[model samples]
Target chain A: MSPEATAPPLDESWVPIRVHGDAGGLEVDWCHLGPERFTAPFFDQTVEDRLRHPFALLFQHRTSIDALVERQRIRPGLPVRGLVFHMSRCGSTLLAQLLAALPRHVVLSEAGPVDTVLRAHRELPGLTDAQRITWLQAVVAALGQRRHPDEEAVFLKLDAWHALELPLFQRAFPGVPWVFLYREPLEVMASHARHRGAHMLPGALGLAPREAAGMPTTSLDEYGARMLARICEAGLRAFQHRRDAPARLVDFTQLHASAADLLPELFDLKLTADERQHLREVAGRDAKNPVLPFEENRDEKARGLTPEARAQTERHLRSAYERLEAERQGR
Target chain B: MSREAFERFRARVLEDPTLQSALQATPDLATFLVLAQRLSAEQGCALTESDLRDALDAARRTWRERWI
Candidate 1:
């Protein structure tokens, strides 16, 4: 773990997907993502497409994670320009889509391998915070390798529960302007009631006792609302901890004058007039499925909330919602 | 594929974008595997269908389930 050592270059197309114990030793498993553009809604979707072929599978590579660390030492990848964290079922995908509309940007939407690295500490016992930070940097460098010569910015849109690990990400990439995007709790809750993400399950994450205690022993919909409340609060608390942060607290609703104001200032991004128009087109499509047009009925998505889900959201998440709504006027 | 042949074939494929694209363009696994084995044999890294199946099964992800 010295500062001066370096390793030979590894191909950027074969990105690492898993970091785990391999026959009692730690290793990284990589899949070849080829040269295709990341136009998919999620990073995993892109990898899954590759997996549907023999080319990406038969040639998978396995090696010590240190190999990537050393490879990164030889060639440090793009520095992360911005981070996007969101409560699930929120508009984070739309924001990520907008950013990825141009070829100059590399946007990783809820990349699973990055999530595995972020949570590696839970499984790899006796791992120190320093090691974790170094590993995080290495992993990010591996993910951010320049696929296109014109690539300028690398943005990572993290999963909802990742907000709970804000301290870790902030520690890994300090001074990187980030935004915590969220929606009305009932809307988020309603969306989850229809199709629940793994994090919404009663005990899927084996979350902290405090989070577990907060969840009711009722329906999964109520649990999803409470879980969203916890995630939203975590992001707000992390941002509030450092008011000087180059960050924004964006609500789902456009009530905030600064909502979706975007990162020309914060992320140090520049867009031409044509690029801006292209992003407007990107935002008009569905975040999860870009082939489909954006559903105009924003309220319709939340209209299916069950009575119990609505009650739980109001009971548990109303305060957090109000406090965040106040951010609009303050902005 | 034997370990040496598999490794050699992979090395060759990694350096050949044309082959990569051809294999990627296959409509299904059967066609892809046939093209892959034929390509390997052309390069002196010949492998049987069982070897390809074994390699797919040995992958960490559920390649069999994926195909199924």
Candidate 2:
């Protein structure tokens, strides 16, 4: 075989599937998939759109960050426009999907690879703070490759726990606009009580052993409420501390009424009238289950909260929630 | 990694209550491997470290190849 034929493909189309550290150092798993695979939803592997794009295991091996950096130096990616940090189930997926509906926008909604890198920082072998932040930048750059000429912006909807890691992200993407999407404590608690998110479960978000020690495991409802409060507290504390960063506190209530106009202005998204119209249509559908029509879930969640549970949430999380709400209202 | 090896590991984790509790209590890769190794010993499955690593890599590859 010719030397060229035996060589691995080094193209911008390939993106990092996962980033982790081994005994040697940092390594990234890369897989090549066409841009269309990204443009469509991959939440459901059974979906026709997703099934059509069967990504081959390119080169049958992983690549190092040095190789990715060399590849990126040849073909740089689009700069990130904004970052979305949410308290989970607070219309974050909706906002991300809305932006994704627009053809010119690249919105990464709670991308697992990014979340894994962020969560497994200290756990990964030989990962120092400096190297971790550098790796984060490289991962985002690889994911932000502008496959289409019209692609103008790349936005990240970080995993909710990432709200706690705001400082790290700020250092990675300096001057990028960000927002913390939050809802009332009771509302968030009720939603979790109905169906617990992975983060709401004990130790799911990589909580320090000391932090998890305080949680009351006997009552799953109380445990969930306490865990959620910690997440909200972390977000509120970060938002308050990073006052100089281009940050905003967006209430869930405001999103339904004005995200179409507000997000563009806040995030500097220059959407055309047609794009706005399309976004509105996308917004009308359930973000998680797109086939279902969007229904008002707040009222249902409020009704679901038991009086005792509501009191428990109020006792544990209300103060932090109130503080966040005050920030959202510009108090 | 063979599909059956992956499926067996998943099934054992799900069926063993003690393993599930240990997993939830300490949700890290190190702890997970330790639990899987114990289970593999009892089940007589040749679940080597390489097998687990290959399983993780294969799972990641499948997720990227398919998921959005």
TM-score of each: 0.85, 0.75
Worst 10 residues of 2 chain A by lDDT: A51-60
Evaluated on the second chain alone, the candidates' TM-scores are 0.79, 0.65
TM-score of model 1's chain A, to 2 decimals?
0.89
Kindly give the stretch of ten consecutive residues in candidate 1 chain A with the minimal lDDT sum: A1-10
Compute the lDDT for candidate 2. Answer: 0.67
Please tell me how candidate 2 rates in CAPRI terms. incorrect
TM-score of model 2 relative to the true fold? 0.75
**Candidate 2 positional error at A328, Å:** 2.1
The local distance difference test score of each candidate is 0.73, 0.67
Backbone Cα, N, C clashes tallied per candidate: 1, 1
- Residue A296 error, candidate 1, Å: 2.7
